[model samples]
Target: MDAIPFLPLDPLSILLLFVVGFIGGMVSGFIGSGGAFVLTPAMMSLGVPGVVAVASNMAHKFPKALVGAMKRARYGHVDVKLGIVLGIFAEGGVFAGKEIMTRLRAVYGDTGTDLYVSAIFVVVLAVVGGLVLRDALLNRSSRPAGTRQALPAAARWVRSVRIPGTMMRFKSMNNAEVSLLLVAPLGFATGLLAASIAVGGFVGVPAMIYLLGVPAIMATATELVVAFVMGLGGSLFYAWEGFVDIRLAMIILAGSLFGIQIGAIATTYVREQLVKLVMGMIMVVVLFSRLFKMPVYLADLGAVPALSPSLHGALDALSVATLALALLAGAGAILIALARGIAAHRRRHGMLEPAAVD
Candidate 1:
């Protein structure tokens, strides 16, 4: 295997990375998983290789996840037992994912690996994002006040099935009894996607909600535990190959920690429906961002006609802009929701005097 080169980080680059990290962490704290999608592409745009961007992002993820999980756990959101069980199985998937990534890099080089990752991003984000968005829109319009939303039909069906000895009960899941056999596959897929794209929460959170019957807040919080486990293990594997960039990881971590705290707090302020909305919105936007980059990768691999340098540059610029837009849209939504929630809370508490008692 050829040694992967690390890009030099100037002051401006460091500042930009820190900002992106902060936004990514904020989104992760709110939605359970998202920072990686933006961070990976942002790093690539900065000239970091695909593998190193993923490896470094993973290295930073575990610690940030630890902090976010701890914060949410304080609010009684995290399910430690469930997260641990799922994470244990996810480790196996992470190793499997790493193996596939290694082979791709060795055989097809960086461009091939980037192409593969981007393609997966496009498909997963499109399908899942569309479904979640549809659900969010429905909930916004049709849901009754003071009533919890119903689980999806698929989730209800899963909850009904009983697998005798394989059944495991989770207090966090309302003491729901589910088969370990069923849970393990979701964890594996989550880990595999995480290793491949640096954001497994895309699968993990939704699976917890729609399949495992966990609530949205709990699902998001619990995913941090899985992320921590996968990120730690994945980082070790990547670091062994000298692909992990400590400096880059630390810079991102610095901003992400602060963002994570704020994001977690925001979750307490907003409704579950909003969480789905933000996650879906970010996914859809990021999907387009990755789609824009696909042509560049295809041209590089000679799978398509060679793009002129100017056209390639234009496409690359557009891709980066779209990625930034995804982050901004997510952050804007969270901040808006948080602000509204806080104002309502204050009003209920009579924090503002009634017309100054005039």
Candidate 2:
């Protein structure tokens, strides 16, 4: 097989990558996953091949996740034991995912691979994003201050299941006993999606929350641990195959590290429902972005008529815009929430009072 050549890093390209990386990192730190969704498409837009973009994004993810996980852990949000177990099983899923990508690339080349990836992005983002948004809306309507958010029905059902021999208890999960069988598949799916698109937290966090009955804060924080493990293994696997571009990975990582720190801090200031809100909103916006690419990919595959050059260019531009919008929207929401939380905190402590008249 021929080696994958790295893209030229012009100054403009470098700056764009860095900015997008920072935005992605902020989202990842806040919600526990999503940086890759923006970073991958941004790289591809800069002329990097799809596989190479995915590979390089994975290369950058582990360290960023590690930093974010450490910060969140300080807040007592991380479940180390749960993360480790899920991450270990997720490695198998990574291997399986890599094999699938390899065969797809070998059989169908870059265009076909891109088509497959985009199609999955569209379907998964739409379905999962819609569900999350609905849940967030419901939570917003019914939840009161200082009260814990209610578990979704799916999560309630999951917790109720009792498989005697397969049950495992975790201190982080309120000492609740859940089936290993349930946790394993969720981890595997998380790893599989991460390998495929570099954003498995979409599945991982929600599954932890809604499937395994992990609380949103802990689930989101735990996802960083899962991302770290999966990313490390995935990066090594891709590097061995000569798909990773170290320069790209390093450039993106530089900005993402800083953004991740800010994001992790923001999580402490906001309600759990806001985390779901930001994630769902980003996913929905990202869904539209990927949707715009479908027709173009279809045309490339000759499954649809070729678009005019101008129209194709228009769609491509629209796709990029929407993806960036997803990042901006999420970041904006988090920052606003953080500011409000700070103001409220100050008010409660009488720190917002005007100075006494002289």
Best by lDDT: 1
> What lDDT tens digits, residue by residue, belong to model 2 across residues 1-358?
5556579988998998898888888988999984787788778767787788888899999999999999999999999889998999899988888777777778777776677777788888888888889898988998777887666687777778898898888776689888888889988998898888777898888888887778888888998999999999999998888888999999999999989988899888888888998888988998888889879888987989999999999999999899878878877887888789888888866753544422
Error of model 2, residue 99, in angstroms: 1.0
Q: Report each candidate's C-alpha RMSD, comma-separated, in the order given.
A: 2.1, 2.3
The residue-by-residue lDDT of candidate 1 on 1-358, one tens digit each, is 8878788989999999899899989998998884787788778878787888888999999999999999999999999999999999899888888888888999988887788888998999988889889888998999887798776777778778898899888977689788888889998998888888787898898888888778999999999999999999999988887888999999999999989988999999988988999999999998988899999999999999999999999999899899889888888988888899899999876845765664
For model 1, which pairs clash?
Answer: none
Best by TM-score: 1
lDDT comparing candidate 1 with the true structure: 0.88
Misplaced by over 4 Å in model 1 are 351-358
Task: Extract clashing residue pairs from model 2.
Answer: none
